[model samples]
Target: MFKDRLRATRISKKYTAQQVADYLDTGLRNYQKYESGDARPTFEGLVSLADLLNVPTDFLLERDEYLDALGVSVDVSLECPPRRPKPRKSH
Candidate 1:
């Protein structure tokens, strides 16, 4: 599933396998292993690949279904507020 998506996206973006390998700073054989499903990328590498492919990491991992199930919306401008600690109650 992951390999198919990676290959399809790479081709759709008109990127040669060697180009991707170079971008990822990995050898051609090592990158080929990723396509062959004989190896998996590290979390950092996954993020880098997703960035280069202009996709979310979940899409590369075939985990986007989980996000769809939750119906979560991605908004770059949304910022999370800091949480305040609760005051201690008197004994």
Candidate 2:
């Protein structure tokens, strides 16, 4: 899914593979591996691709469905549940 989105976005944005590789500071072969599903970019590379393509990182990661399926809004703020102390053992 990620590979498909990446390729589609690149094509839609009129970016060549070589162009994307240059922007990513990687060799064309390595970039091709990303589209071929043989490799994945690091976290920073993923963010860089999103920024260069003017898309959200979540979009590239295909996380929109998770939000939609869970009825979660982008503005929803979730806090971690508080941890409670364990009960002491009886003497």
Candidate 3:
């Protein structure tokens, strides 16, 4: 799935493997391993790929069960919780 996601995003954005390699400052063969799922990128490389692909890092790396484990849920509302008033001083 990681391979598929990487290849799909790269194709959709009209970038070749060599172009991605250049952007990453890596050898083409090394970068190809990432798209083949034979190797995974280092943490820094993951961030760079996410930035270059214009996708959230999670979009490239996350699985559904991982989301559940993280207890993350999306909220569309922009409202902030109300702040509490200051307590009165005793005489």
Off by over 4 Å in 2: 66-91
lDDT (10s digit) by residue, model 3, range 11-67 = 766788899999999999999889778899999998998888877667677554665
Flag regions of model 1 displaced more than 4 Å: 70-91
C-alpha-based local distance difference test score of model 3: 0.74
Give the range of the ten consecutive residues with the poorest summed lDDT in model 1. Answer: 74-83
Q: Assess the local accuracy of residue 53 in candidate 3 as a C-alpha lDDT between 0 and 100.
A: 81
Best of the candidates, lDDT: 2
- Model 2 Cα shift for residue 1 (angstroms): 1.0
lDDT of 1 by residue, 30-88 (tens): 99878768898999999988898877777777776786887743322212233235469
lDDT of 2 by residue, 1-91 (tens): 7877788778777789899999999999899889778899999999999888877778778798875777753431222233245469999
lDDT for model 1 comes to 0.75
**Local distance difference test, per candidate?**
0.75, 0.79, 0.74
TM-score-sorted candidate list, best first: 1, 2, 3
- TM-score to native of every candidate shown: 0.72, 0.72, 0.67
Model 1 clash pairs? none
